[model samples]
Target: MDSEKAVPGDGVVVRAIRAGEWGQARRLRLEALRDPVAELAFLESYEAAAAKPDAHWREWTAGAAEGTRDRQQFIAETAGGEWVGSVTVLLERAGTVDPFGGTVACDQGHVVGVFVGPAYRGDGAGVTRALFDAALEWAWAADVERVRLYVHERNTRAEAFYRKAGFVASGVRATGPAGVGGFELEYEMKRSA
Candidate 1:
């Protein structure tokens, strides 16, 4: 599902990222890492992400881009062609281990790497909403039992948005993705019966 939001003059469209757009993916990720709340919003630090080589980006982007079996990244870009935001969904098969070493009790989509450029944040958060809409649609299409995301304890703003997007707390707490002291609360949208 492609969504259009009134951000730029001509508006922005949300769609799955492509493999050849690795450069845009890398640059957009760096931009996201620079956001003020990025420390709590993302798992990796700016320095760590920026230090990755072009090859790392190419391979990573390729894996997360459309055509991959396990993941898909949906990005929002203006009609003028500037990327505004992105949200990626990763499929975790039941009986497998997740990135955090937790057992995946069921097939699910784990949403991550959510971001909207500063210019397109807040009142213009339509970009973010559109991004999530696309990401969630993709997850549901993949027939996951549910879609979940982890948010930092102190990141109230992000948690609010996730709630608004229909995800509710799962009563599970785990170490933040960075392996830091803070806890990351799990939020999920279980598939309707």
Candidate 2:
């Protein structure tokens, strides 16, 4: 349970989703889906997300509530109890076919659903970095060879953030379902020795 904590003095606590916090999770996700750049930054739409039943969110949250190795969701909450951001990391085993129709040649942590509220963005607020730090920490501890994430080709802000976080373009591209509408760019960070 204590495995989740952000660096000090940021006024935000980074932790895994709790079983009963699904409603909050649902709210934050819907909010993220409504962002101006959501079409380019997310694979799902606000309408699609809002249509999901409470049970769906509860089940999804339960899986990530315990910090499991297969998948984990890290969230950032303000000292005042507002959920500002989240990141989900999923283990992609070697020899398996990835969601993008590619073979996963190495054990890797595939990062997804990355989002931070616009109010907490930029260098002035450390929320984004804190959430990613927790996510990367979890991925590395799970023994993944690397952590990778996909950004829509037009999502320049996301790509820039990933680059600043030590991730580099892998020269690989993938196209998601029609919801995504276009190709995605892959960026990754290799695990340290």
Across 78-169, the per-residue lDDT of candidate 2 in tens digits comes to 88889999999999999999988789999999999999998788877888898898889888888899999999888888888999999999
Please provide the root mean square deviation of candidate 2 (C-alpha atoms, Å).
1.6
Candidate 2 C-alpha error for residue 132, in Å: 0.7
In model 1, the number of clashes is: 0
Checking candidate 1 for backbone clashes, the offending pairs are none
Cα misplacement distance, residue 152 of candidate 1 (Å): 0.1
- Candidate 1: tens digits of C-alpha lDDT, residues 93-176: 999998888899999999999998877777445777778777888888888999999999999999998898889999998886
Q: Give the winner by lDDT.
A: 2
TM-score, every prediction: 0.92, 0.94
lDDT of 2 at 162: 94
Task: Tell me the number of clashing residue pairs for each predicted model.
Answer: 0, 0
Poorest stretch of ten by lDDT in candidate 2: 1-10
For model 1 the local lDDT of residue 91 reads 93
By summed lDDT, which 10 consecutive residues of candidate 1 come out lowest?
1-10
